[model samples]
Target chain A: MSTSHLHPFDAALALASSAAGLYTGHTSPAYWNMVGPFGGITAATLLQAVMQHPDRLGEPLSLTVNYAGALAEGPFTLQATPVRTNRSTQHWTLSILQPDAEGAPVVTTTATAVTAARRETWGVGDMPMPSVPAPAQCKRITPAFRSEWLQRYEMRPVSGALPEQWDGSGDTSLSQLWLRDAPERPLDFCALAAMADIFFPRVWLRRARQVPAGTVSITVYFHAGSDLLATTGSGYLLGQARAQEFRNGFFDQTAQLWNEAGTMLATSHQVVYFKE
Target chain B: MSTSHLHPFDAALALASSAAGLYTGHTSPAYWNMVGPFGGITAATLLQAVMQHPDRLGEPLSLTVNYAGALAEGPFTLQATPVRTNRSTQHWTLSILQPDAEGAPVVTTTATAVTAARRETWGVGDMPMPSVPAPAQCKRITPAFRSEWLQRYEMRPVSGALPEQWDGSGDTSLSQLWLRDAPERPLDFCALAAMADIFFPRVWLRRARQVPAGTVSITVYFHAGSDLLATTGSGYLLGQARAQEFRNGFFDQTAQLWNEAGTMLATSHQVVYFKE
Candidate 1:
C-alpha cells in the first residue's frame, strides 16, 4: 500500500502490514494529548484497523474504547481480531500493546467495534438541534491551551468556554460548540468517531480548574450512514455535551453530534475518573 | 457456593466455580426475554463475574455489552480476562461462549467493564429528576405483555404506556416510569445495571406498535456508590428514556435512573437494530 495518497486520518492509522492485523504507527505530535496521543485519534485509529481488515462486513454502528494504560512516544502495535460475524453484523475486538522495560507486551488500550449492514427504515429525529451561530459567524477558539490535540480541531464555543483560571463558581457543566478537523477534511465514520470525543471534560466546564481526570470508558453510537456524512462534507458539526451527575470521584457525560442540516450523526457517552 | 441463601439477583448470577477467571452459569427462566434470558440480566451477570473476581479492583464505573449471538437454554461459560490493571483502575474483557451442536465453542456475548477506586469529590447533579407521582400513588402495571422479563419487574408508567397494539401513530418517543425488581430486593450495582435496560424501546413508545427490535450494544455508567444504594433500599427508581433519532434500521436511546430523593443512580445509552 502506498502512503502518499492517504488523508491525514488514514495516514495516521496506516498499518505496517495487513498480515496478522499488525499495526506499527507513531503518535502524531499534531494530535498529542497531555499524557499520550489524543484519545479521539487513538479511537479512530482502532476503528480504522477494522475498516481496513479483509473480513470487515459493514460500517461501524457502535464503538466502545477503554483506556487502560498510557502509550509512549514511539511506535506501537495494534492487533484487531474479528471476534464474531453474524448474518448481518460483525463484532471486532482490538488491543493496543506497548512493550515495557521487561520486553513484555502491556495492553494500553482496548476497544469493541460493531458493524452492520444498514437499510432504509422508519426514521425520526426526536432531539432538537441547539440554536447556535453558523460556523462562519462564530469565532474559532485560539490554541491557548497547552494541548496539541486541542490544536488539531477548530472549536467555536457557543455556550461554555474553558475556565480562565481555577474558579469553582460555575453553575452549569454544559458546552455547545461547532467543531471540525483543523485542516478541514471531509466527514467519514472514522473521522466522525474521533470527533465524537473532542468535547472537553464536563468537570472542566463546571469548575474552571484542571483536576486529575481522564475518561475510563467511552461508547459511541453512529446514527448517520456514510452517504449522509459524505453529503455533510467538510463542514463544521454542531455538538452539545453535558454531565448529568458528578459523584464519588467520577462523572458521566452525554453528547450528541449533528450536521448543519440538523441531522443527528452520533450520540456518545463516557465515564470519567476524576479526583477532588 | 451455596445458592439457597442468595438473593434472586445473586442466584441468577450464581456460578459453579471460578477457575482461571472462568465462570459457569445457567439462564434463569424468571428473567427470560422473548428468546433467551433478558439482555439486562445477561449484562448484570457478566458484570457480576468481574465483581466477584479476586483480582477485581474498586467498583464498576462503566460497562458495555455487545450481543453477538443468542444464548441457548443451558449452561454457559464466561471468561473474564483482566487485560490491564492500573494503580487505581482495572480493565476487563469478557465473553460468553456456548457450545454449538457440533460441540465447538461459539461466542454469544462480549463485554467490557471498568472498575476504579473511587473517592469523595466535588459533585453536582445537573439533570433534574422528572416530576412524577410517588410510587405508592401510582398503580403498578399488571403483566399485560407476554414477556416474562416484564412480569419479573413492577412498572408504574407515569407518561408513555405500552400501546395496546402496534399502530405506528404515536407522536413522541418518551417514556417515564418507576421500576423495581418484582420481589422487592435491595438495590445494588447489578440490579441497577439491569434496571437501566428495562425501558421498552423508544420506537414502540412513539409508534404505539412493535417491530422486530433488539439492542445490539448497551452501556451503563454507575453514579451511585454502595452506601447510597444501600440507603435507598428497595424503593422504586424513577426512570426516563427517549430516543434522539431512529434511522436506517437502527435507533439510539438514552435513559437515566434516579432514586426517590432525586439522586441519580446510573445513566445508560444503547443502540437498537430495528426492522420495519
Candidate 2:
C-alpha cells in the first residue's frame, strides 16, 4: 500500500483522489521526455484514474490521448468523467491540467476512453507476428541521446534503427523490435498503454533526418484482457511500426504489439507533428 | 441559403446554431443506416460543428468519435467545446444528446477533434496506393440489401466483396474499392470523412458470416488539405481496408484512402463490436 515500494511505472501512475472523478498525480523522472514526461505514461496515468473510479465499468477497450500542451514539473489535476454508461459499455472523457505561466490552470492533455465488459466470441489474429531473431540475439539499444524516457525501456531494435547516418536519404520507415520495461514490470492495461507509444517518431527513421517531431495524438485498441496480459507477464513484446504518409508537417504511424507466444495484445496508431 | 439547394451531404450535415458551442441537427434519410444515421455522417456532422464555429482554428488534423449509444431517428443536441487552443492546434470535445425513451436527453455519441494550421514541410507517401482499374473500368455495385445508406455511395469493389454465401467459411478480411459520392458531389473533408467509414464490417467478410456488427469508435487522420482535396474534385478515391485482430466480441480495422494520382488522402481506424 506504500508508494515507495511500487515499481516506477506504478509510482508514476500513482494518484490521490480528493473528490469524485478528480485525481492528483505527479510526473516521474524515470519516464521523462525531452519537454515533459513521456506521453505514454501520461496516457496510462489518465487511464489509471478512470480504472480507480468507483463508477468505472468493465475494462479498457480503447483509448485516445491528445497532447494539448506540455506538462510542467510537479503536480497536475486530472478529471475523469464517465460521460455515458450503457448496458455493456461506458465512455469517459479525461483532461489533465497544470498551471500556466500566468498562474492559471490550463489543459495540458485530453483523452477519451471506452470500457466494456467483454464476452467470449469467435477470435482471430489476422496479422501474424513478424519473424525475427529472439530477444537474446538482438542487440540492445544504448541511448546516446539525452531522453530520460529512452533509459526506462529495454529496447532491442530488429530493423529500422535510428539512422546510422542522418543524411536524409532513407527510404523505408518500418521498424520491428523487441521491447519491455527496463525493470521488468508485469504486463497490464496501463503498462500496455504506456508501451504502445514506445516507438519514436517514424519520420526520423523514414527520412533518415534528425528533425523535431512529437506525438500530437495517440490511439490504442486493446485486444487482450487482464488474463492474457497476466499470462504475458514481464516478457518482451514484439512491436512493429511504420508510417503510412508524411505530409504537411504531420504524419501518422500504426504499430502492433504481440507477446512471445505470438498472440497480438494491442494495436496502436498515432499522428505526429514534425518540423522539417 | 435554403437547405433545399444544398447537396445531400451538406443537407445531412446541416446544423442550426442555438448558443455558443451548441447546435441542433437531424438525421437525414439519405444517410440512414440500419438503426440510425450512418456513423461516418455522424462523425462528419460533429466535425462540421467545429468547422462552423466562430472560435475554430485551422483545419481538421485528427478526430476520434465514440458511439456511446444508438442514435434514434430524430433531432439531437450537439455540443462542441474547445477545451484548449494552442498557437497552432485547437482541441475540441463534442457530444450528442438525444431524448431517450423517458423523454430525457442522454449522451448518444461523443467525440474529440484537433484542428491545426498545417505548414509546408518534407513530405512523403509511405503507403502506396494499390494498383487497380480506373473507376470507369470497374463495375458499380448495386445494393442487394435494404440499407438506405448503401445507396448513397457508388462502390466498385476490386477485392473482398461481400460474401456470396452466409456460411461461416471465410479466409481474409482485406477489402479494396473505388468509392465516390453517388450524386457526384465535390471532394471535401466532410465527404471524405463519410467515405472513411464506407467499408462494411470486416468481420462479415472475414468470417463469411453475416453477424451483427457496429462501429464503437472511429478515428481519422487527415493527410490532405482543402486545396489538395479541391484538386481531387469529385473523382473516385482508392480505398483499402483490413482487420488486424478480432477477439472478445470486438475487432479493430485500419483503412487508407488515396486519389487516382496515387496521393494518400486519409487513414482511418475503428473498433467494432460484433455478436457472433
Candidate 3:
C-alpha cells in the first residue's frame, strides 16, 4: 500500500521494520495529549501492529491497554507477541517501550481476536440509544483550550459540555456527543478502537475541575464486523459515556459507540487515576 | 498460617510454591463449571498468586483475564511476573499454562495494582443501587442445574431470573440480585473478584434459547480498599449486570457490585462468544 496519500491516523500508525515481532515508530505531535500521545492513537497504533503481523488470525474481539509509565516524546519500539492461538481464537500481548530506559514498558496492550467460523445464532441489543438531536442539529464545540488532539476530531455536544468551574451542582457524570475524525477517515477496527477512548474523563464531566487524571487501563470490545464498518463509512458516531463510581483517587467509566442506525459498534471500559 | 480451617474459596486458591515467581495449583471440583473450573475461581486464583508474591505491593486496581484455551482439569503452573513497579503503582503479567501442552497458554491475566498512599479525596457514586427487596425477603434460587460453581454462592434474584427455557419473551438483558459467598467467607479482593463474574450470561436473559457461550475477556476495577472491604465483611452484596450489545457472534456485559450500605465496590465488563 502506498503511504504518501494515507490518512494521518494510518500514517502515524506506519511502522518501520526492526526485527521479528518488533517495529519502530515516532510519536505524532498532531495527536499529542497533555503528556504523551493521545491514548486512543497509542492504542490504535498497538492494534495496528497486531493487524499488520503476518501470523495474526481473525479480527479483534477485545483489546486492553495499561498505561504503565509515561512515554518520552520521541522514537519508541513496539513488541507484539502472539501469546496463544486456539482453534477459533488468538491471544496477543503487545508493549510500547522506550529503548535505553530501565524498568517496565511505557504502555502494554493485550488483545483477544476470534476467527470463529460463526454459525448463525441469536443476537440482542438491549441497551437503547439515547434520544438526541441529529448530528447536523448539534453544535460543534470548537477547542477553546490548547489540546492538539482535540482539534483532530469534530465533536458536537448533544448533552454534556465540559464544565467551566466546579459549581458542585450536578453530580451525574454523563456525556453524549457526536464525533468523527476531522479529516473524515472511514471506520475500521483501528479507527473504532481509537474512538473508544475519545470521550473526556468521566471525572471531568462530574466535577467542574480537572484533576491529575489519566486512564490507567482501558478495554474495548468490538461487536461490528468489517462489513458494518464499510457500510457505515466515514461518518459521525454517537458516543455516550458515564462513570459508575469514583472513590479513593480512582474511578471507573463505561462507554458505548453506535452508528446512526442505532447499531452498537463497540463498548469500552476504563479505570482512571485521579488526584483530588 | 495453617489453612486447615480456611474457607473453601481460600483453600481452592491455595498454591504451593514450585519455583521463583511461579506456583502450582489443582482444580477444585467444588468450584468447577460446566467445562473446566468456574472462570470466576480461575480469575480469583490468578489474583491470589499476585497477593501471595513476596515483593508484591498494594492491592489490585484492575485485572484483565483472557481465556486463551480450555484449561485441562489437572495440575497447572502459574507464572506471575511483576513487569514494572513504580513509586505508587505496579504492573503484572500472569499466565496459566499446562505443562506438556504444545500450543498456547491456557489463560493469560494482566493486572495493574496501585499502592497509592491515598489522601482523603472527594468521591461520588452516581450509579444508583437497583430497587430490590432485602436479602432476607428475596427467594434464593437454588441451582437445579449441574454447575458446581453455582452452589458456591447463594444468589437471590431481584429482577432477571434464569429462563426456564429459551423462550424469546423478554428483550431486556438485565439481572439484579443479592449474592454472598456460601458458608460465609469474609469479603476480600479475591472473593470480590469472583463474585463479579457470577451473573448469568446476559444473552440467555434476553433470548428464549441458550446458545453456546463463553467469556472471551473480563476486566474488573476495584473501587473499594481493604478498609472498606473489612468494614463490609462477609455480607451480601447487590449485583446488577446488563448487556449493551450483541452482534457478530459476540456480546458485551457490564456489572456492578455494591454493599448493603449502597457503596459501590467494584465494576466489571466482559465480552462473551456466543453461537446460534
Fnat per model, in the order shown:
0.88, 0.89, 0.71
As for model 2, its CA RMSD to the true structure in angstroms is 1.1
Q: Which residue pairs clash in candidate 3? A: A121-B276, B166-B208, B166-B209, B167-B208, B168-B208
Residues A1-276, model 1: lDDT tens digits: 576776666777777754867777777776788988888888898888888888889889999999998788888889888889998789888899989999898999999989999898888899989887888888888976798788778899888878777778677888898999878899988899899888888898787767878888888899988899999998989999999999988998999999999989999998987888
> Which should have the higher TM-score, number 2 or number 3?
2
Candidate 3 lDDT over residue span B15-53, tens digit each: 988676799988888898888888899889988898888
In candidate 3, which residue ranges exceed 4 Å CA deviation? A1-4, A100-119, B1-4, B101-117
**Every candidate's TM-score, chain A alone:** 0.95, 0.98, 0.92
Model 2 scores what on Cα lDDT? 0.93
| Model 2 TM-score (2 dp) | 0.98
Query: Which lDDT tens digits does candidate 2 get at residues A163-238?
Result: 8899988999999999999889999999999999999899999998889888999999999999999999999999
Off by over 4 Å in 2: none
DockQ of 1: 0.88
Clashing pairs in 2: none
Docking class of 1: high
Please give, as one word, the docking class of candidate 3.
Answer: medium
For model 3, the interface Cα RMSD in angstroms equals: 2.5
Judging by lDDT against the true structure, name the best candidate.
2
- For candidate 2, the chain B TM-score comes to 0.98
Better model by DockQ: candidate 1 vs candidate 2 = 2
Per-residue error at B193 for model 3, in Å? 0.5
